[model samples]
Target: MKILDANDKELMTVRKIERDGNTLVIRGKIFGAMPMVARLTPKEARAALKLLDFKTFFFLLTLLFRKG
Candidate 1:
């Protein structure tokens, strides 16, 4: 999904996610040019989870495990 700023400007688009050990690796692009990789530690992941609702959280889990 595409992440946008307050003015609807494109930020970075998340392409895929993978879990490596205790961190969540996010692979995507920045401004649709430079490749970007972000690793979320367990503590950071928990902090981000706080912004998501119960339904959204479950939905994401399903998507993560869904067969392509």
Candidate 2:
């Protein structure tokens, strides 16, 4: 997955996502910067999903629908 700014410039790349036991591992990079990874347990991931702002979610939905 690719993250873009409002102008549609690529900001980050989501390289990989994998499950390790009860946790989810996310690996990605910040544009022009070092790579980063994060691990979140199922509970934490669910909470984070709930915290997504409406505009961001709408932007993502637009991207999806446009592609389809």
Candidate 3:
């Protein structure tokens, strides 16, 4: 998996992805954040994983924000 900065600069990467039960997980580190675990349920994690691309994700957010 690839992690990047706001400017789209490559920060770090993981050789593999891992999952356990309902949780999706990743390893490695970013510029400032620690080597940490973000646990999300199968459904929640799946929805989130679908938004890995920033462009589409932000577009959704912008649409929501505009509506709100």
Supply the TM-score for candidate 2. Answer: 0.62
How far residue 30's Cα lies from its native spot in candidate 2, in Å, is: 0.7
Candidate 3, which segments miss by more than 4 Å at Cα? 46-68
Q: What is the lDDT of candidate 1?
A: 0.91
Q: TM per model?
A: 0.65, 0.62, 0.44
Two-way lDDT contest, 2 vs 3, winner = 2
Clash count per candidate:
0, 0, 0
lDDT of 3 at 22: 62
Off by over 4 Å in 1: 47-68
* Higher-scoring candidate on TM-score, 2 or 3: 2
Ranking by TM-score: 1, 2, 3
Candidate 2 lDDT, 1-68, residue by residue in tens: 98899998888889999998999898999883879898999889789779889998788778856853
TM-score of 3: 0.44
lDDT of 1 by residue, 8-68 (tens): 8889999999999999899999888999999999998789989999999889989977885
RMSD per candidate (Å) reads 4.7, 3.6, 9.0
Q: Global CA lDDT of candidate 3, please?
A: 0.68
